[model samples]
Target: MKKIIILLLIITKISLAFEDCIDFFKKERYLQAKQCFSQINQTDPLYPYALYYLLRTRVYAEEDYSDLLPEMEKFKNTAVYSYFYLYLASINRFKNPKLALEYWSKIDKEALFKDDIPFYYYLKYQIDKSLKKDPIKEAKKISLYFPYDRFYGYPVVFENINILSEEEKFNVLDRLAAKRMFTKAIYLLPYIKDGQKKYLYSALLYMKNREYQKAEYFISLLKGKYRASAVYSYIFFQRKMSEKKKYFKELLKYNDKKLIWKAANYLMKKSFYLQKYKDFFYYSQFIPEKSRYYSNKLWFLSLYYYIHGKKNKAAEILEKNIRYFSEKPKVYYWLYLSYKDINRTKAYKYLKKAASIKKIDFYVIRAREKLGLPLFEGKPMFLKFYQSKTLDMIAKLKPIDYKAAYIEARYFMKKHGVESIAAVFPELAARKLSDRKYLVRYAYPKPFLKYATDNLTYAIMRRESFFDPYVVSFANAVGLMQIIPPTARWIAQQKKDRNFDIVQLFEPSKNIEYGRWYLKYLDRMFKGNIFYIAGGYNGGDGTVRRTLKRYEIKNIEEFVELLPYRETRYYVKYVYTNYKAYQTIYGRK
Candidate 1:
């Protein structure tokens, strides 16, 4: 390896293909580099360079040297011979460093590129010093090779000192220290590549020796740059410098956002653990306003409100930001308690309002169950259209597929039931549905000017099903609104004054009308708790009501924190997302 590196360093006639192969080899693409080297047209005079690459390829490829051994015999007694010998010696059979050193020793140091001497010395130094055989002999051997090397350069040549410099020594020390090649690190210090490595390694060595003062002096060089490196992170954490906690204030100057966030949280935690709230406040600007984390921040301060005996101010902080919760239900639940403790009416009102929307389903269901009200949900409505087999099907055959459980609406339609249909009605969100037309035509409140005039629900339907006239879930729900057949039949009977069979629920028009009515009922019954509605839609109102019995608790936050099931959690999220999409895309907020 030393001979190869040395040859590489001085080659004035480097072939592009050889360089390309080297690049590929370093990238770990051994086969490609081998191929590049092999493909280097024998016609080129640089075949020796290509052959050198091929020699190294077998090492990386971990292939038997026999495949390339015949070719190796041709390169004996040349500059290449030394490299081949060194390469052979490096192949460990049983991790036998001494045996490998034998082949390396055979290298004719007398027949080498002077520039290759440092690399050779370094590799030999690594092996000898690592094995702890004899440092004095190894160091003396290193000097023989790197006589020109500064500082570590010793046992003078008959001529003046060699060209080795301070910088070279520093780098060598850096490599040795980094590799945990401690013997080499200590012995090769005068040849280190830079003073920083000397400082870093000295600090590491001192710390290992429990010489804290020397360690401090070494890392103290980093007074200005310590904040910018992973080194600080290692030192601060691994050293457990509890007393030097104040020193990390300098780390704030580092600009890595991720690291900063971690640092900020760490500082905040340290302050809390140390019972130093004023210290924690130093990073108040980076604090997340989200309830869970911010609440923790408040808890850490303790003096913010609770500790100061100003319960009212703390309660107000919770309320003003409850609705902005990153974790909705949990946040609202806390705010509910704060309000209830100070003002009962406000708390109930806030609780009811929270129950209406969907973020906090468990809490909402429990709230409605306690209130003896039916579940709240956006009523499902199936669209029904009747026409002879002659009418043309629309281009968007089943837009609900695009809904992908994502709901949206159609503004204008011109097929199935009648002439051009536009969902411009102000009252309902969109056009009339088709599932159960019978219910819409008769039961749609006779003063019914509202039914005829409003199509607000139609817009909501688009986001729900995309007007797919026929759809069903495993629950026996059918058609666009995804209404369960039994539920539809019951809803239809009350509105139309006539009972209908479950099969008729498949009819687009009848299914839609009944579905829409059920949706409206759910919405009103649960007082707008979107969460309960989505859950009831999937798991049924009975399940929600049943769950509520075990849900009562003094801490509202504790009540909602306990609901399990990932799907229900997301079900509530998407439904509200649908609501927001409807409002944003169609302006029906």
Candidate 2:
């Protein structure tokens, strides 16, 4: 027993030391991390990890890691051998391309870290090019899997684009546009030979970037059905009501089903917003029953008629089209609301059906609230003793082989954050585990609890970056809380923090601090309305205030649905759902 106690103490000490060194590495204090790593005794179980990170720290610091290559053979029998091989390949790539290729050839590509996969392909492309071999496949993989890898991917794609097929090129262009890398898309435009495709993409890119005049120029250069599509898009971005109505009506005359659908969808929403029942019904007919928005059209028509003192007509519309909705919690809730006034028995039936839906969503929660049922039904006790199967498996390895894998998993979690552990261990990705204790905890982690422990804080964090402290969004929002640099800087000034830098926003504590401060400020501005707070967080507070004044918000549900910005509307719903989920899971309520 005494011997076991001593061993446990030694293990605890090693774990603490390894975690401390990892903290230094995460903070980019390479020298300190290296020193910390160097201090671990060779006999310790964690020594292999310490040595590996010591070499990694050197690579990150851009210092000479060649001397450490001889020491890296120690990693061959360890779990981190794949990473060492990757780093080894990266180090020798430019100096001795053959040696890098040799090292890379020994690695199990499947074991490469998620973030490193792009770089691996990148190196393969470079080596293939250096050897005068066709690198089309590697280039395509980088473009498809990691186009946002600005260092290697974008540069490689721009250089080798001529070799890609037209379909592949269009795919790359579409991905770049989706990632909002419009500058790269614009740069590639000169390479596209097809005039129609080029013109359409150019207009779309310019419109996405909000360069309306440039977009209009490109749209003018277009012709035929494509030009009509472009005009509809251009009109969609403009605020002129007369122009929207005119072109949308003109769009209805075109035989292009997609453009007709888009025009009709827009006009339906607009007419509903303006209470033009005639125009709303006119446009609603153009919406195909096959369209996903068809149900939304039905809902809007029902609401319009219901509000205009036609309750029986509203019930008939909902009952007739109820089969169209695959996810019917919201539809059922709406039916309950519509029927409660005229027929309580029918209302109760619909309310019970909505509350009984297995899925938990905004409407489901509201229905449960009305029925006095538990908002969520799950085993919260599962979290109390939760332990990841991957870590447990690692712990069962031979003592000499255990710590490296353990540290590897922990380091991956630290770097990538949240569900990234599953990325490292594919077994964790099983759908069966989604509702299990581990995944539930993973889906709703409570990081930075000391800074702010509220359900809303965790909800926002889950939605913002999924607890990824180093994540930078397309809009340049940083860290777990997704605080923009300008907002973070302003927050620093408000707090009188003299030494604060925008880079600190990538630190979890500081990001959460600034984000929570901003949330509190919004709370005060909006007088504690969560819907407005969430909308303000995504859209601006001014937009939320204007929306509240523009629409007579009867309730939170109506306000969320009516939010003009689709992103903000969804953002509000997601944050609220996350908040409620957290509350339910943790028994906070």
Candidate 3:
């Protein structure tokens, strides 16, 4: 009995130790994880995973591929035997194409994890292409596995994309457009050589570039009535308010639903700047009742009427539009208020329903406050660290090993829902081994963090790259902070660092240092307004300043919502949101 109890205790200790190792692995402390895995007994259930990680850390993370032969030999007959073959193929794929092909052919791809499939296909294509396989067939076959956005070890050289046939070019163009790589899509135009496709691509490129005149010219060249006129009107709709309003009035002459839909969208945004209740209410007639903007328009209309002391109009609009905005707690709260003067029972019913729903948004908190319930129960219990057997297998491969668990966490969040973001936010923020935390430590070497406030720094870092040091944005922004090469050079010059090479921007410590210094600089320029700071960081200082000058921003919220670029508008909001989450997590508030 004493021996059995001792054995049980030992097992529990090993289990706890394994969990700790996994936490280190998840954190990307590969060296420490390797150490932890090295100490595990050979007979343990997790021993295979330990051995795999130990070899992987040595080869991939440490970049000491010299003595992997011994380790490779040991894993050959194990359940994870395929990984040994894969590692050899990956390292030698370019240098020894024949040997790499031999290694690749040894593996059973079906036995690999789902995330590993893309890497396998990508590597196989490279190997096959290097061995002089038919270019057309190889391009078509590999296009199936092409990632929408960037991925580790995916060859992004323009030559690879340039070789695709015309049909394949269109297919890849569609995918590139979906990924918002419009600039890269333009590269395919020379090869595409079709007039209509070239015209469409030109219009899209100009639109993306925000050169409306060029956009209008190309859009005019489109053949079809539906595509041409709609795009032409959209160009006008995207212009200044005065310009768009004139186009909107002219588009009203057309009986086309697309034109009408565009007009309604225009009115919805325009109404905010007009800010006249009566004018918007009058204009609301043009918007179709079934249009997506209809409910949001009614929401604004009802609120405006209530504010203007027209309770009858407010109640009428709210009652009619309640179904359309049911998911919005403010809608329920407003509907309750609308019923207050006429029906006390109905008012109480709606209020009660509104207060029952729990969310962190303004209306939910207001409803809870009105009901005398706690504003929130507590911060969410973030989902527990999750691991599975397949992840263990995936973690055995180089480079992919580093991202495997992190990718699984992302997949887990998607499988659950958006609410899972709160549960996984910390993991997402710190998932990559070379993430912001690693970079920030170098930036703030002293006892007290400096340059930028910790929360703000974290927010910017998360927004920039989600801690991916290797990330290069479609706009040619590089490294963890996504600093464009021109800006990086300027930053280098400003710092008077003569040794600053453009390639060094890809280095984590250098990237973070430069990024933080720029933030400090922007903080001075924007006078500490985070909205302006974030907007400047994303959409150039001049753009942010020009927008601010153009409009009399009623508040920070108004300024953020009305920013010219849709991407920059959301960029500020997301960064601020991330800052708040960082404060909550780190108790930095």
Candidate 4:
């Protein structure tokens, strides 16, 4: 009995010693943990953890590249990491890159950790490249996902072609042409058989190479099948009008309203005086309900009456057309003239309406001066919508300058009704009153600042450009909110400003004005779905649309999680980071 009791005591002592070592290791006392792990030779899960630390400490302690290899191997075999990349990528294997490549080759390239895939594929590609005897063939092995390879001179053409068709295909084809690879792309069209697609590509190719006859030939072939398509017919008409007046005159025989309109325009251009006015009426009556040509037709019709010296008749046409077209600049231009000639009061009313909306368009300016309309100098148009939870989240993640936080708070209070802004009001006041005179320092608009109290947006701003107004991203976006040039120009056009140049978009007032409009536009494009809108803003509207349709995202959060673009994924993270930082500093509503 005494011998058995002594044995139990000895067992208990050893067990306690092991537990003590684990405790020390948990405390990160690596040297002590290493010794304890060595004492046990049974090879347990804890064995790996201890060994990983042992190698890591050895590498740190000795700073020897030679020792790094074996230690890495042992550690990989022992320790459990989140990805266990160290196990697969142990430095000891570097001496035999062939063996290392062989080992890495066996790894499921598609089953990599989310952040590690790009690097993994890049590494594999590098290895394959190193081993390749034929550099030309190896060069073609590059990932189909990325564009811009002057070496191969391949953009996303081959990859994009496999999936898109019709209008979508044409969009891609245009992009390919923009890259100056249209002639090369012609050879690729043989793999596709859609008639419209074939005709379109053929026409583009012929047009670029100055083969007008071939272009006409290809377009004629498509007319029988795609005659109902106004756009296609219109395209054909334009080409034919330039090259063959006889054929252009023959095309007017078609009874289709859009085609008739095209014919009438052609007749008018060719000085067919007897038939021009009659054909114009036929064309005018056939304009589609949603036709972009409606305003132009109204203007032309009203002008015809005015030039024929039918004053009352012209006024009636102007009134009817103005009501039909709403505030369109073209209609307004004619109406302003009609009203000035007939009744100054009516002219002033319509001109004021046009000027108040915008005074920069050609027609609007004419109307404004004729009626002596007041300038639209009131407080700027703005938008508001922010959730506290969303704002709080932003504050935790984003970085916001002093004045930005203040302005964002004000916006939340006014637009989103986020009561959280009150808590941070003092900070906002301090910053606004600060003596700092730097450009863009205190230049943040009140509404924009308030809206930006979002956590992610503020955090993202820091990493994006340190809030520099002039920072232009690789994608050609500028200003604090990073508005794209094309998008800015579009917004300016919508607001009736023809002079809004894309180059001057970095100006603070212009940048924010257009940036907010773009955000709103994106929001609308995604159906007020913030996640998709955010993704759309970062990746592309088309990409976000495709992804949403691909994943069939019914919920914004799920869509965000499923985004294929890592840039978009990180952008979401960064936007929320900015929002969180804003919420934190501003003390969320």
User: What local distance difference test score does each model get?
Assistant: 0.50, 0.74, 0.64, 0.50
What tens-digit string does per-residue lDDT give for candidate 3 at 400-426? 333443444345344444334322233
Error of 2 at 75 (Å): 4.5
Candidate 2 TM-score, true structure as reference? 0.78
Off by over 4 Å in 2: 1-36, 43-45, 56-80, 108-115, 129-147, 235-243, 274-282, 288-292, 306-316, 379-407, 410-443, 470-476, 498-503
Model 2, global lDDT = 0.74
Q: Which ten residues in a row have the lowest lDDT in candidate 3?
A: 439-448
Worst 10-residue lDDT window for candidate 2 reads 424-433
- Candidate 3 residue-wise lDDT at 319: 75
Model 1 ranges with Cα > 4 A deviation: 1-218, 227-244, 249-264, 281-304, 307-309, 321-325, 349-589
| Model 4 CA lDDT for position 161 | 51
Q: In angstroms, how far off is 381's CA in candidate 2?
A: 9.1
TM-score of each: 0.27, 0.78, 0.58, 0.38
Model 3 misses residue 262 by how many Å?
3.4
Candidates sorted by TM-score, descending order? 2, 3, 4, 1
* Per-residue error (Å), model 1, residue 505: 56
> For candidate 1, lDDT tens digit of each residue in 1-589?
9999888855723454555766787798989888777776654534544666687887777766655545645544334456666666656423767766876776765444444566566556556755666545555455444544443333322122233355544544444444444454454444444556466666665555455676677667754443244344544444464633544555555654555555566667655434466767875545676423565455434324533446567667766655444545544444555566687887777667656655324455455544565434443434454332111111122221222111111222221122222222111223243221111221121111223222334433443455454455544566556776667667767788475777665554565567567666776766766656655555566645554554443332332222333344455544554444344333543
Q: Is candidate 2 or candidate 3 better by TM-score?
A: 2
Q: Candidate 2 on 1-589: residue-level lDDT in tens?
A: 9999999977855665666888888899888888778777765655656667888888777877666667657655344666777777777777878888898887766555455678888888887777777778888888766776788788878777888777777788888887788888888887888688779988988887778789878987888877888878866876667767776766666678877887788878887766577888988998888876798798888877766668778888998899987758877887887787899999999999998887757788889889999876674322223254434434433233322443455554454443555533322222223452122544565645567778988888878876656678888889878988888888889999999988878666788889999999999998988889999999989878777786666667667766767678788887887887788767673
Which regions of candidate 4 deviate over 4 angstroms?
1-174, 177-181, 190-200, 220-223, 227-292, 307-312, 328-333, 352-373, 380-589
In model 3, what lDDT does residue 332 have? 73
- Top model by lDDT, which number? 2
